[model samples]
Target: MTNVKRKAIMVSLIRKMKEKGSWTGETHIQKCTYFLEEFLRVPLNFNFILYKHGPFSFDLRDELTALRADNFIEMEPRRPFGASFMPGKVAEVLETKYSNDIDKHKEQINFIVEKLANKSVKELERVATALYVKKNEDVSKDDMVGQIRELKPHISKELAKQAVEELNDYIKEAEHNHIIL
Candidate 1:
């Protein structure tokens, strides 16, 4: 799109976001980001960003970067969104993705978070165990059997079984204890 057209789209997005804090529709968001990167290049600031088709808003910079990927927003060199109004569960995983520790696991964690949001801690443990099984498949058949074998002394099957049963509970307990760190 031409610069003028991009500007027009950005202006339109700005008007919508100003009125309701977001714009919805695939073409709108993609085109909006296609322009926003340029608009933002001027060091100008706005309270809202047109995140996507989800009328969501965020209040951070890094978060904007994740949501503004090439496929998602068509922006380059990236910009962190200043605010988000995504649903809480969706927002949480997005926040965690920008977090330092497990940043790389954002996508997987987001999917799990979505699935786990509706479940009890009891259910989460079942899920975690199931996921562990799938993720660990072929440790004996894949390439990690030797390492697993070497670590077997430190990792007992019995202990792991117990852990599978108690994982969700433990995560909850740790959270209750203020131990997420």
Candidate 2:
């Protein structure tokens, strides 16, 4: 699909997420969108790379900025430092316009958001970074924790181990559902 269409779909998807009480924060948005395109095959062409916060895409950021500019979403800074994306005035109109496409992928979107919605940003960072490590390296499950810490020295070993376990769970479910990861 064209970039324009994809952006419209993203707007609608975010609105749906908000309605479902899944719009936790920016990290939620990033990870959910990553799963939407990479695992669920929504085809938004985000060139994700293993960045500090795990899978990140400049294209996604640009699209979000454009959405803000168009008043489809608003970013509000939370106390003590992070931000959240809330639906703006135009979000409902955009959601309605793209209702059919959003509805088509609603199952995947809901599954992803529900699975990931409650995670804190730190937990998400650990999980996403661990997933990146698993995808890019040939480390065994036994050594996954150490391997992850080697790349991301700041994470506690306990958190690294937990992240590996969480990533394994996600992988297993994805495989069971025949969703390519």
Candidate 3:
């Protein structure tokens, strides 16, 4: 898809996430976009790596900055946490123009947003890291938990195991719904 359409989708995602009561911080968007691309197989083309919080994409960061500049999204500061993202002035226009593109992936978007919108950043980190390990390394579920702990020593073994199990359920659900091939 074209860059404009992708930007529209990003805006739509931000809007949907906000509607679903997500914090809509950059971290939230990053993780949700990671699942949208990696788990749901959307061709968003953001190159992710296991970073400080979890799967992160500097490219997506830059795109977000550009979206802000173009008035496709705006950031609002929230006390005690950080700034959150919201749809900007022209966001609706872009969404309307690219509604078809967004519609094509709406089911996947809804699935991920529903599963993840209410999660805390720390939870996102653990689960996304679990997915990263599962996808990048050839390991069993138990071994993936070990890798998660190795990568994120801050997480407890029990939490790591739970994250891995949650990721497994997400994968199974995505597969059963044909969200992933």
Candidate with maximal lDDT? 3
RMSD of 3: 0.8
Q: How do all the candidates rank in terms of lDDT, highest first?
A: 3, 2, 1
Locate the minimum summed-lDDT window of 10 residues in model 3. 172-181
Clashes of each: 13, 0, 0
Give the CA lDDT, 0 to 100, for residue 106 in model 2: 69
**Model 1 residue 6 CA deviation in Å:** 35
Q: What does candidate 2's lDDT look like per residue over 153-172, in tens digits?
A: 88999889888888788778
Lowest-sum lDDT 10-residue window in model 2: 15-24
Ranked candidates (TM-score, high to low): 3, 2, 1
Instruction: Decide which is better by lDDT, 2 or 3.
Output: 3
Comparing 2 and 3 by TM-score, which wins? 3
Please, what are the lDDT tens digits per residue for candidate 1 over residues 29-113?
3323322322122211323333332112243233334444322222322234223222222333433343443333223223223
lDDT of 3 at 137: 74
Give me the displacement of residue 119 in model 2, in angstroms: 1.2
Q: Per the 3 Å backbone cut-off, how many clashing residue pairs does candidate 3 have?
A: 0
Candidate 3, residues 1-181: lDDT per residue as tens digits?
7899999999999999999999999899999999999888889999998898989999999999999999999999998889899999989999998999999989989998999988999999999999899889779988998899899999999999999999999988888888872
- Model 2 quality (TM-score): 0.84
Q: Give the higher-TM-score candidate: 1 or 2.
A: 2
